[model samples]
Target: MNYEKGAKEILENIGGKENIAGMTHCATRLRFNLRDTSKADTAAIEAVDGVVNVINKAGQYQILIGTNVPKLYNQMENLVGPKEAGSKDSANNSGSSQGIIGTIFSAISSIFAPLLPALAGSGILRGLLLLFVQLGWLSETNGTYQILSAASMTVFYFLPVLLAITSARRFGADMFLSALIGAALLHPDYIALMGDIGNGATTSFLGIPAVLMNYNSTVVPIILSILIFSYLYKWLDRVIPETLKLVVLPLISIAVMVPVTIIVIGPLGVYGGEIIASAVNWLIARSSILAGIVVGGGWSVLVSLGIHWAVNPIMINNIATSGIDYIVPFTFACNFATIGTALGVFFKAQDRDIKNFSMTGIVTIALSAIIEPTVFGLLVKNKKLFLSQIIGGAVGGAYLGLTNVYTNAFVFGSVTTFPAFVGDTSANFINAMIGLLISLIVGAMIAYFVTKKEERLVKN
Candidate 1:
């Protein structure tokens, strides 16, 4: 269906948007926190033209919208206003800690979902630029490189602003004004002041010992700050008179929050980020191969269940903080193995339609790192190929870990973006290529042999 019609149907079926306390979109779902669940029409929502399915979990009414979710979310938001708010506690909160954990992940998914396209595009550009520079056709010190680098890093440098806008929408705050708070966090004056603090300058805000922390490209601090800002803004809106509200609200919120973040939240956010980074690092430290094996082996299971997003924060945080990541090599191996399995499927298929679809899956995996086509089209229909691919993933993961291979940037796992995994030295790239080759050979051979055997048994 058209975006508008789909959006209208969605709104009407979900109690006309008035029942929505807050709304957020993830990679494939539109999550709604409703003031009253009884108002929703679950059956009609399921039958909406663009909807894939309906889910209710983590105290959310989740409508599956596939990749078009962001588009639908925007259309819905334009129809309604900035969405409404619940009380001090959001309606999504649950009593059990496990449910709360799911809620947090749901929020993270929604917050990051809108940002991925921009990030993916920038990452690709950065990868291409890095490739040209490595080939000696471009120079890092050249103006072209400088311009592209700025383009690539813009979202990262002003990440707070993007997070502020998305999180504000999720938490039911004024998105534009919260973005101003984000802008202020990265203001030149504040950045310059942070430089002084880095150089051992002591600073204070209204007699409070200021604990300044760099906010650029960070995740935790910005989200925390926005959460605080949302409540403060909502509370002020209630107390202040409507006539004076616009003039007084933004002024008071900023005046209070900027200092609050700088002196209190920012430092704590740094601590929180460090803890997150450290935990991921610690896992690999215990034993890279064991870690790789566990991640590689279970990665497919996680992806099949849509739980792989749980690992995204750690990998992104590692790249953001340390400029490198060890956790994602397993992803690389898994992608290569899946591609190999798809190639085997292509050769083994007797049906013309199956053969044509398998070829498409092969191309999809080789270029885009998306293997759902292969997984659903071939592997789920053929058990042997799936198991072989998983085994190949484990083998590749262990070998990469043994070689100490690492990726220096955030990249979707695929051969098309191999340059993204290249490090300061060529060795990293060589090792990764080795891992790729081994994964392909092992997985493809197993799939071929197993398929042949199964076909023979069927004939008999």
Candidate 2:
């Protein structure tokens, strides 16, 4: 693919660099906050070579370009220049019109999208380390194991720091100040206070008792704090005299926000995360098979709608709160089901373009666990293939749910990361493998037969 040429065409169709208010990219999509989305031509953009799909959703114009998105994004970024920090784009200014749900979805996607690669890598490492231990190749007490464990766990343990950096970018807060707040929440003294709380040791600020909770690996606290800090910093920037702005702004913002976070936002955010996790847990507990069937069968639909990012927090919170999560475990089935369906297309489809595209999707999905190329490029155009995906995913999901398989770490659902499915019992991992095979074999079989039947009908 001529990324540079394709990038130029994309910019031209998206109303040129001048139309862009903000620009970012995730694993497989370029997200643009356009000053006037109406000025952008979606059809023309999609017609560009290497471009798979163009979606105007969640207040951003997203271009799906598969695993090569980062390379193209670099080209586009070079052309557009660095996106202005805290640009007041329509996406930022028109939150009210987008409604609460859209606003939240956009915020979550923006804040977490960039972090997925790091999270996925660390998760894979965690799984690998566990495999080494289980196979007796690594001893838990060995210094080598300790260092490797730290490498795998560092991102998760200091998640707030990472989240603060990303959240600051999203909310237009000073990254350092936001990160300072996250660090302050995890200060060793504050963590020690968790132990002291039982000994009648309580801390207070301005006569208000501060609730000291472990903010390490928490999702919502830093986000809520940074959101409030953004508003405060903007107001401060407006009021502070131009000469004293540099040091005074950060000083005052940190001083006020950190204490406020400890006193109010931290506890509220913790409670909020708990509530969301509890709701998911309650659903899973009610009827695991039903929950699995819905999530697994409908997972691709959520991704197609671009709202699947919303589930990330719940999965993270489940691990932080319960030491394990079932969400991603079930999605494993969907991932394999997608791979199987794509393979079916490669084998059965008559069109040269569709067959080649399906082969590309299979390799991409198997390695990176990204399904956009498959879901958007193939399944959306073929009802029979999609039905195969739904039936295969549901059957696998039901089995996984019935068996209650879960994982301790958050990993991408892919062939390489299958070790991440290690659960409480040996049988748990076995059951997960069975689910993957069931989804793959069933999806391929159904797709193959259905496409053959379609061919017969065409002949008639």
Candidate 3:
């Protein structure tokens, strides 16, 4: 597909590599924090071969490039050279233009973006392992089972350590130093201390009572720690003499920050995450149907706008705290609805390019559950198809809510991982499949009829 040519054309239209402030790529898009977004020629960039669409959202200019984004991203990165560490360009641009909410969302998304693949792979593996156990294909006591289970569980068990690295990069802190803080929170000594505290033991750091909690699998505490740590490290780096900075600064920063984190920041972050998760629980408990409709129907829209990341932490918190989450279950419908939209288009569209595009979207969604190619490449361009997706998702979501379906693991909605939705009762599994089918069928029918009506109108 002449990827090198496509990369060159893309850079040329976005004011060349010099216009870029910082850049990153995700599963389906190239995200650029530009010095001046106005310098970008969106139309010209979209016109480039291999590009599907362009979006300006969450303080970044995004180019949708389907599953081949990494290849394109590599080529583009080579052209732009290496990005500097602690680049505050995004913060500056986000503050002035994106406002507080957008800035926060942008930060959260970028911080977690790099971890998605690891998380998704581990999550799917966990789901599959559980399914195997339940199906009696693998015994829980088997050595192979234990090894596979450990492989699946490692990332989640040491989640704080991973978040520490990503958060440090986001906040312009020392990644290794930040990792030390995360490791400290998950230290075996501290974990044992937590057990002692649970069974009546007291501990203190410097006269103040120390409150320790298990930080493994937690989302917020390490990130908050790193954010504060970054500020403290920068301050220490400035004051310490250059000659002494290497040893004294890290020592002092660790001494001060570790205590402060254990005594204060960690608890605050944990409680904060709990509060957010509890609030979502309250809303869903009050009315699961309404919650389902909103999340299911609106999830694709959120994905389109690139702010879906705001809800991810809440889902993770729900899973960590409660062993189950309902938020991700609804988005399954949104994904299948996208597949339905493609099927409708494939059958009705006479244009060979349109048919091929729809065919590709269907295959992409079926295989990886990635719908951006379908969403940005096709759905957004056709209001009728978009409506089909919304209606289908809403219908399917309502059904799931009515039955109170949920997934035990943090799974990316996909055809391969349907077993993740299995519950204690057979009805739970049955209902999930029913809801998925409802979404698919409804979306396909609506899209088909709507396209037919549009064609008739054109003929008339």
Greater-lDDT candidate between 1 and 3? 3
How much lDDT does candidate 2 score?
A: 0.81
lDDT of 1: 0.73
Worst ten in a row by lDDT for model 2: 451-460
Residue-level lDDT tens digits of model 2 in 1-460: 7999999999999999878877777778887777778889888888899888887777667898888888998899789886732355634544533446766776788788888888778777887788788888999999999998999888888889899999888878788888998999878877787784532346888898876677888899899999888889889989999999988998899899988998889889988988888988999999999988998888888887787889988897777667688888778888888888877766886776667777887887788899987887777777888989988888889888998888777777888788787654678789999988888888888888777522321100
Alpha-carbon RMSD of each model: 4.7, 2.9, 2.8
- With a 3 Å backbone cut-off (N, CA, C), the pairs that clash in candidate 1 are none
Counted clashes in each candidate structure: 0, 0, 0
What's the distance in Å from true for residue 142, model 2?
1.2
Query: What's each prediction's TM-score?
Result: 0.83, 0.94, 0.94
Name model 3 segments beyond 4 Å from true.
84-86, 196-202, 453-460
lDDT of 3 at 48: 85
Candidate 1 has a TM-score of 0.83
Residues 208-285 of candidate 3: C-alpha lDDT, one tens digit per residue: 997777787889988889989988887887789999988998898788888888888888898899898999989988
lDDT of 1 at 406: 80
- List per-prediction Cα lDDT, in the order shown: 0.73, 0.81, 0.81
